[model samples]
Target: MQPRSPNTAVKFAHQVKHWRLAEDIRAFCAAARQSGAATDWTQWAENYAAAIDSLAAPLGMPPDPPAGQHDLRDYFRGDTYAHPWPFDKDGQWILADDGVDG
Candidate 1:
């Protein structure tokens, strides 16, 4: 399912994309650590294959969430679950919190 507010969805997508990029970097670092500092022809080929087989890979299957991150839609939309954001007296998202004049 998608969010009711298009702006909110777009903002969330942007944030998620950034997170995905970071995850990709972390995955690459992990692979490098496993392979060691030096890389011969076989090691290079294996590393390349492993990189593409990672969850962050463009062609690899998606991986499960690290631990949390389940049921984030309600937290972000606030239409169903009471979002823990809007750390103000009023229950409203701030301008910097991806508020779109709602």
Candidate 2:
């Protein structure tokens, strides 16, 4: 998947794009190992992890954590306070034909 922002995440994605192939991957790992933990690789991992863990930090994203009762109702309900909504409208999501706003 691709990162949304042109910040640390985008920079990190570009850094690893060359490692897509297996042979290049081994070489990349070797380079990281040579650099040691106190290096870009570690920072990259931390930034990537933070981007992932954040509720909406990464724009294009992985699956959302499951929502249940007692989960933030605002997450599922729009500003209109619509009930039985299947998505959190406050985020960058839109509704289906049945719920579409535009």
Candidate 3:
């Protein structure tokens, strides 16, 4: 089942901001990795099919949660089981933590 419908009031205006989209992608990928969904061909195929269907339609799937509405940190918590990724106090995703002076 679809988890939830995205906000449509912002249809004329952009809803998901760039930073949030990037973080969401990262989190989704991380969950897939931890859940072994990355290697699951069946799931991949299903997702691919759905994407294709969306592309074929004049209008694709509705936009997901906007920048402030959804948090990447919480989206995949259950699927990933463990949160290896780090986020700053402000809840922004951290790319890396190299112990080096730049």
Supply the TM-score for candidate 1.
Answer: 0.32
Best by TM-score: 1
Question: Where does the lowest 10-residue lDDT sum fall in candidate 1?
Answer: 60-69
lDDT per residue as tens, model 2, 1-102: 644434557555643452344344445556677777356665565455444442334344334444443566655445434455445644444355655566
lDDT of 3 by residue, 1-102 (tens): 533544553542232343344455556766777887776664564455444342234654465543432355465546443545455556566666534467
Worst 10 residues of 2 by lDDT: 53-62
Q: Which candidate is the best by lDDT?
A: 3
lDDT of each: 0.50, 0.49, 0.50
TM-score of 2: 0.20
Give candidate 2 regions above 4 Å deviation.
1-36, 54-102
Q: How large is the C-alpha RMSD of every model relative to the true structure?
A: 14.1, 13.7, 19.9
